[model samples]
Target chain A: MKLYGKFFLINLQSQMQYKVSFFLTIAGQFLASISTFLSLLFIFSRFPEIKGFTLNQVLLCFAVVQMAFSFAECFARGFDRFPSMISNGEFDRVMVRPRSAIFQIMAYKMEFARLGRFFQSLCMLIYAMIACGVFWSLSKLAVLFLMIICGSIIITGLFLVYAGLTFFTVEGLEFMNILTDGGREFGRYPFSVYGKEVLKFLTYVVPLALYQYYPLMYLLGKSDKILYGFLPPIGTLFILPCFAFWRFGLHRYKSTGS
Target chain B: MIEVSNLTKSFRVSTREAGFKNAVRALIKRKYEYIQALSGISFRIADGEMVGYIGPNGAGKSTTIKIMCGILTPDSGECEICGRIPWKERTRHVRDIGVVFGQRSQLWWDVPVIDSFELLRDIYKVEHSAYRKTLDELTQLLNLNRLLKTPTRNLSLGQRMRCEIAASLIHSPKVLFLDEPTIGLDAVSKIAVREFIKERNRNSGTTVILTTHDMQDIEALTERILLIGRGRILLDGNMRELKQRFSRHKKIAVAYAGSLSSDMLSNCDGITVREEKMGRALIVLDSNLLTVSEVIEMLSKTVDIKDISVEGVTAEEMVVELYKAYRI
Candidate 1:
């Protein structure tokens, strides 16, 4: 943890070298996410609700997924850019370090500009908290916190899988965007809004809905069972298999020619 | 100490012709060719020995270094460094070694050089006092006091390279692997780097394995040379002995006041006249077969000799000749 703090400070100092470029990237991130928010609003303007839930309920879902995604993008940008790291021979540097390769790679890059999207999601979360009409309770608040944290972990696991596959092939695997970016867009509505088949796939296969949908059901008082509120922690286990895949790929790692 | 035995590694490279149609075909069905990078190569180095690992391009010099540094796993054979198998105990093995790739910069491009050093200190878990002492010594030896404050991108290549050597030593590793450390430096920088490396090895007994195309680096820093070509160890011997073996033939240039016929020296065995002009002649002869005085006496008999000079083959010429002899 201490080393992580040092890495964080150094990365911040490096990013601050170009002050204008840093601020512009943050603004660009803010504007780009605003278009997604506006599109969601346009969908709600066409109908009073998506499926059986009101706009405020769907807004809560969108805000949670957005916050989790932005957090992952902010901290785990190294895994997202793993292809370039391997191609440019930076991975060889990582291997020679006395630290864990994962830790070194995580410290290699941090996209602080994604905090702009994080800030926008916080505003949406605040508005949904006021308008969504959920009864104030400590357990309900705890479930919301767990949903965001575990959702971020799940997405980071997906990034890990993406990075691991790069060990076999150096080219960018564009299809993985379906699970990472596509999950964010499709998650603007609760998983139930999609049909039963998609919900089952997300629940058992990828487990995106385990955090975003089930725990959310308990938060909104749709289900009184405390078990639903605890599903996000179970979703956190998704990282175990993702990490195993990463280790397997690491063993097969063939470093680029110097 | 380092031991490598029967190490072999191969890579499967995808192949495609350079055209849109071929590219589309490759996307559907690819062909791969296997390149044997290292084929049953083996060597050992004792503690505190400076050895030059030299080879032609794509001759597995970097491959051997990568394996020793714990970066790549060999397809077969074993490499043990300091009682640890590099690939098996990678984290532990890396703690005792430092690697520098000349074509790449390990320092953070946008931060001051000291920050990278400090981060490395933390990464290696060095004590604060130990880190400070090592940094002070390196800064003094490499003359890094001025370069430490500047960002890596802002510094000149030579200055950045000096800092790079210092950064790798912030942890004071037991073994240092330098791959092409002086690829494109000016004469002064090259000498400075070579001097520092020699000093470090002498003072701390740090084992150094250097790989380079520059024979000057080998001639200046290493006593033992390991030559690899076509994925095999072609020669392993002392630098002095190799120089002696290649330096048997010597060239002598003479300036005289009178004209001398080239045929006059041709009668003597093991002597060839390289060039002849109005008042000067260049002669090459086997030093083992004829003494310099004997040749000078014979030349003085024909023309009034004014001045004479003898030269031996240089290290560069010796290496080119070696490469040609090995047919690499």
Candidate 2:
């Protein structure tokens, strides 16, 4: 944790060296997400509800997925950039370090600019918390927190899978964007709105709905079962196989030229 | 100590012809050619020995270093460093070694050099006092005081390289691997880097394995040379002995007051007149067969010898000769 702090501060200092570019990137990230937010608003303006859920209820789902995604993007950017790191031989530097390769790569890069998206999602989450008609309770609040936390873990696990694949082929696999970026885009509405088949696919294959949909059902009072509220923690288990794949790929790593 | 025995690694490289049609075909069905990077190579280095690992391009010099540094796992072989198998105990093995790849930069480009050093210090888990002591020593030895405050992107290549060496040493690792450390430095920077490396090895007893195409680096820093070619150890011997072996023929440039006939020296058993002009001649002679005095006496007999100088074969020429001899 202390080493992570030092890495964080150093990365901040490095980014701050180009003040204008730093601010511009943050602003660019903010405006880009705002367009997505506006698109959601345009859909709601055309229809008051998506699949019998109010705009505020759908907003809650969007905010949770957005916040979790941006959070993962902020911290796990290194894995997202793993292909370039391998191609440019930075992964060799990571291997020589005394720390764990995962830890070193996490510290290698941090996308603080993604905080713009994070802040926007925080605002939407707060608005949904007040207007989405959920009763105020400690357990309900805990489920909301779990949704974001485990949602980020699931997304970060996907990023790990993406990074691990780079060890086999030293290029970013474009199809992986379907699970990572596509999950967030498709997640703007609750998984149930996508129909039974898509919901089953997301639940069984990727488990994006384990955090975003089932626990969300408990949060919105659609289900009173405690198990639904706790499903997100089970979703965190997705990281295990993803991490195993990463380790397997690491063993097969063939470093680029010196 | 480092021990490598029967190490072998091969890579499967996908090949395609350079055309849109071939590229599309490769996308559908690719053909791969296997390259044997290291083929049953082995060597051992005891504690505190600075050895030069030299080879022609793509002869597995970097492959050996990468394995030693715990970066790549050999397909089949045994490699143990500091009593631990590098790939098996990677994290633990890496704690005792430092590697510098000259073509890459490890320092954070946008941060001051000291920040990178501090981050490295933290990464290595060095005590504050120990880190301070090592940093002070490195700053003084590499003259990094002025450059420490500058961002790595802003510093000159030489200055950045100096800081790079210092950063790697901040933890005082037991072994240091330098792969082409002086690839594109000016003369002064090269000398400075070489001097610092020698001083560090002498003072700390750190084992140094250096890989470079620059024979000057080999000549200046290392006593033992491990020459690899075609993914095999071609020669392993003392630097001086190899130089002496290649230095049997001595070059002598002669300046005289009058013209000399090239046939005069060409007719001799051990001398070959390389060049002859109106008043000067260049001669190559086998030093074992004829002494310098004998050649000078013979030259003096034919022409008024004004001045003469004897030169041995340089390390560069010796390496080229070795490469040619090995047919690499």
Query: In terms of DockQ, which candidate is strongest?
Result: 2
Could you tell me which 10 consecutive residues in candidate 1 chain B have the lowest summed lDDT? B259-268
Which residue ranges in model 1 land beyond 4 Å of their true spot? B253-260, B263-269, B272-282, B302-307
Residue pairs with colliding backbones in model 2 are none
- Report the C-alpha lDDT of model 1 over B238-302, residue by residue, as the tens digit: 99999899998888999999878788688779799999897888999998899888888888888
Candidate 2 CAPRI category:
high
Candidate 2 residue lDDT tens string, A1-258: 988999999999989988998998888988888899899999989998878888899989999999999989988878988999999899999999988999888888999999889988899999999999889799999999999999999999999999999988865499999999999999999999989999999999899999999998889988888899899999999999999999999999999876
Query: What ranges in model 2 sit over 4 Å off?
Result: none
lDDT of each: 0.91, 0.91
The sequence of per-residue lDDT tens digits that candidate 2 reaches over residues B24-135 is 9998899999999999999999999999999999999988899888899999999989999998899899989988889899899999888888889899999999998998
lDDT of candidate model 2 versus the reference:
0.91
